[model samples]
Target chain A: MIDNTMNPFLIFISACLINNILLIKFLGLCSFFGLSSSIKNSVGMSLAVIFVTIMATVVSWIIFHLVLVPLNLVFLRTATFILTIATLVQIEEMFIKKYLPPLYKAMGIYLPLITTNCAILAVAFLNIDYNLNLLNSIAHGFGVGVGYTLAIILFAGLRERLMTAPIPKALQGYPVAFFLASLMSLAFLGFKGLFGL
Target chain B: MSKSNKPGISAPGTAAFLYGVLKGNPVLVLMIGLCPVLAVSTSIFNAVGMSIAVAFVLIGSNVIISLVRKRTPGEIRIPVFIIIISTFVTIVDYVIRAYSPELYRQLGVFIPLIVVNCIVIGRGEAFAYKNTVKLSFLDGIGTSIGFFIVLFVIGLLRQLFGKGELLGKVIFSKPALIMILPPGGFITIGVLMGILTYYNLKKSKV
Candidate 1:
């Protein structure tokens, strides 16, 4: 397993490009498709995801290693991790509403969806699955978020252009968007084995 | 589109089941659980396995949530629903792992992801919470059948074209390898959705 000895820098890059959470791992496709209809919303969603993934991954790591593993409660991971994420998202929402009113108004709408954005939960599980240490897990989380932002933003840009392009009536909305995703997935596959991670 | 969101008359079991199959087909219409649809539909075996697992979880969660709907406080209802759904998911996950280890291995992360499938929780919040236990049970089976129909078709096509096999039996001499890859999943679902949308539009026009 590349978990223990993999360098942090390499982990960051690999997670971003080589193993993108959306195109490759398919962790968070819901928002990738749902929010990518517009660049602004996609970027906003990505920012929210970046914040939540880092926090959720780190916290889940602590809970899994310090609490679950020690107490032989590993089976509770699926339940516990999701509960932790739900709570974290709730807290983040409350905090934003309390102090960062402007940010709340801008990105608050996407925060509630984060609780169900499999990417955050997926990252939490991946951290444990990969057996990454605390630092590595955080790096991986950040990498997944950055990769998601990069992919969604790029997609949003393409979609903005697609709006003007002539499309068949049947393929107007999601069908065309899905075809675009396939092309993107095909391109992303090129990054496979790039760093051999 | 309006029909998809309108609550089904859960009292009539067949009506509830048909509602799921045609109007609220989870994949083509509501698009609730596309992750599993796209990820596990590469083969018939995997597709059926996933659908059954989802059916088990959905039925179990729906029945349980309905039975306790009155007691499940609104403030913590979502969390309560998540825990209940995850419990069923965990059970299915272990059962699959124990008996059909191969299918479980093939499914990988998706089995666990079932805990978070929007359709299960979506139905719970939308229908089960407001309906009776018997109706919720039928609704679960209805939606599962609908989901199964989509999964089965996609799996059959993907396996037939992508691997030149159906349920592990050879169908074609040469298969289109791309049909089974991630992109293939997207393209298939996209085209299928397009066809379904076009048909529905034509049907509604007359």
Candidate 2:
């Protein structure tokens, strides 16, 4: 377990770089590979992911620490947290549509997809598993979002360039994209010892 | 490739089973269950363990969903599907923890993350809900077999290359560390897909 006094900034940076949720930890990759075809759409997806992950982490933290632990219902964590996230996505959809129409138009469809994205749930479980404080949990969640954003954006850029390259018939679409992901993961691994966390 | 046999028109058990193994392979073809494919494919043992666990969940969820397909309201079907799926996932999680503590420790959160695995819920929603119990069960088995095969191959390569061993027996003096890392998983799957595509294209042309 990390010390309780560990700096939130360090947690955030480490999550974003060294322990990148997508490249390093290999979470939320379905959407990462699926939605990284374009920069604009990937940015939208990342923003929605950022919002949903932070909210889900904070909410799951409170539920785990205050409710499940006390009631000895930790077993219900998987079902309850998923249901909560699903409901949260629904409510978030409605709320965005009603008050923030423009924002809703931008990220409305992507919001529902967030429920299935493993990164949110992964972050929620990780926060508890690491025994992080409330602030650290939020920071970690935010950092994961940023890391995901970084990965997707960079991947989108590479893919955009790959569009023009004369690729072989066999490795045209997904295979090539995955190779790109492997290289990116390789690059991200270099950050492992930077902070020594 | 028979003209007379079309999906939903004829209910062939073998057909459905074989379809999942090749045509509708969850990992290589459908690309649904990449999370477990990437995270747990570090070794052949982990690959088999994760496959069995997922296979159990997939079979259970498919059977139950097919049984209650008529009764479940359309509006609430997704949640109902989720509840059933998570119940099975929880069962597998506890069973693993009690019987195999070391495997459970290695899998850690991934056991629970099975709840969100697209393949399980994908089968529940796509095939089981509309198909009969027998067909759904067969589909579950076939899909899991496909998943297991791909995972095993990837794990085999990774373990053999990464650690210079197979199931803890050293095969080489120098192991490539990248083969077991996250990047190795992506590269292996990517190259495998490329080979599959190559063969698929060749077959199509012929």
Candidate 3:
């Protein structure tokens, strides 16, 4: 049952909206809390992450299957995957700078900030760490990254709006954001049934 | 190396270690790493196991990151950092699985999720990368203790009110189911954060 079409699609939607890596899984809380202050940066950071994640997933899959597995070096899976991601992020930064300098400036510190984002590293590890083939991994990368984007965008949209919303004095910043996350996680609890797939 | 103060101990090393456990306060001051704190604190046993596992990653990764911090070019530091952090995570995962499958199952996906816990990488980047090994080790202990303190409190509350017991002892038969569920975690952490903020504010005013 190596079905990629429907399963991948479901996985994407579910990961994005339901089992959101941020709200539920709590994968990349650092970036979620740190970079999500402004909607503009959130959008840029989200897209850059989505872009690099697809690339990292593809490359890491290849390395895991072709190099690590063959050499009895599976023990080094996490190390290799992370280093490769770091290297790929470097490549991405340079490529963006040379090719998309304008867009690069728009992304700003988030470009480098993505390096520490555990979500990015988590995706890389999941691609091979969970033993998905190239296609499955790609679907996962797309799914999880979109899932990340959706949550961040949604949160950013709300938080951006909240900038004007009358939040209580104590609950203004992280407090309110956390409360929202808690509620969102509760809302996401509705999606556990989709796992019937 | 850690035991004998003269072997590799230094002053700043002492500071970072203690800071992580208490002052920097991964659970309170840093106010990050709350995911595991909430999710895994449903039981006292889980809090204990997770804390130990986190301590191992903090110590090993902190030391390794500090050792390589200088050579890691600024442009590529982040990636290099991930590689290092993920490596230690994998090693811990394997060691844990081999020796302790029960704890592994209880931790569930969180053991792997440690790859992303900012406290581990945060300590690496913030303290370990610049300090000595001994100090990094202490930082690991301190941070773990802080995490342990937070998790223990949450676990105690959840196990008490949610399960009618502290560690399955059945202190009271009628427990609140909501307290053990996910929302309960948020509520508890929220109140805890408020109290911490209140204390911090009061202390500052003094």
Candidate 4:
């Protein structure tokens, strides 16, 4: 078990780099691959993931401690957390669409996708699993979002270049993308011993 | 390719079953539900456990959704499917915890994450909702088999190369430790996918 008493900054750094939710933990590959075809979509999706992951972490943390624990309903964690995330994504989508039209337009399509991103829900589960307090949970959540953004944006840049590269027809799309991700993940592996954590 | 069989119409059971196992493989083809595939496939045992758990949830949810499709409202079908899927996942979670503590530890959060696995929800939304319960059940089986096949092969490769062992039987003194790590998972899948694509392309040309 990870030490829950570790510094929040360390937690943030560890989450962002060492145990990156996407590259290391493999939490959110669907969107990682699906939305990474273009930088525009990657940025848009990253913003939405950042927003939803942090929000869902906060909400799930509160619900798990306050509602589920008190009611002795910890077994409902899976269902409740998913439902909470789905609902949060829905409400956030509507709120953005209604009041923040420009931002909504930027991330509208990605919002619905965030509901099933798994990273959001995984963050929620990690917060509880690691027994992190609210502050640490927030930090971890933000760190994961940042890590995802870093990986996807970099990958989008590579994929844009890949579009024009002469490649075999069979290995044109996803196969090549997976190879790219493999190299990126290999690079991220170098960050493992950072700070000796 | 039968002319009389239209695209909108669901395929027959045997075809549906074969489709997931071959043509429409969830991992290799549709490319959904990849998280668990790369994560728990470090060892053959973990892979088998995960496959069974996923099969349970996928089959349970697909069968239930097919049974309740007519009564379920279209606007809310997704949520209902999620609820049903989560219910099954929770059951699998507890069952594993009670039965095999080691696997329970290894799988950890991934067991719960099955609720959001695109393959489960994707199958629920795409196939089970429109098809009969029998077909959905077959699809669930076929898809799980597809998942199992890929996962087991990856696990076999990783275990053999990573630890110089298969099913805990050591075959060599030195192993490429990277084969069991995060990057190894990515690279293995990438190469396998590339090879499969190459084979398919070559066959088509022939």
Task: List the DockQ of the predictions in order.
Answer: 0.58, 0.60, 0.31, 0.61
The global Cα lDDT (0 to 1) of model 3 is: 0.74
CAPRI-style quality class for the chain A–B interface of candidate 4? medium
| Index of the highest-DockQ prediction | 4
Q: What is the TM-score of chain A alone in each candidate?
A: 0.96, 0.97, 0.89, 0.97
Interface RMSD of 2: 3.9
Candidate 2, after superposition: displacement of residue B19 in Å? 1.6
Candidate 1 wrong stretches, greater than 4 Å:
B1-4, B8-11
Of candidate 1 chain A, the 10-residue stretch with the lowest lDDT total is: A1-10
Clash pairs detected, candidate 3: A16-A147, B13-B135, B17-B138, B17-B139, B20-B143, B21-B142, B21-B143
Clashes of each: 0, 0, 7, 0
Model 2: DockQ score? 0.60
List ranges where model 3 is wrong by over 4 Å.
A1-6, A128-130, A165-168, A194-197, B1-17, B64-87, B162-164, B171-182
CA shift at B95, candidate 2, in angstroms? 1.1
Q: Write the per-residue lDDT of candidate 1 for residues A1-197, one digit (tens) a residue.
A: 33858988888988899888888677788778888989999978988999999999889999999999999989888899889999999999999999999988788989988887877887887788788999999989999999999999999999999999999888888889999988998899888777776
Q: Which structure is stronger by TM-score: 3 or 4?
A: 4
TM-score of every prediction relative to native: 0.96, 0.97, 0.85, 0.96
lDDT of 2 by residue, A88-150 (tens): 989989999999999887778899888888889888888888899999999999999999999
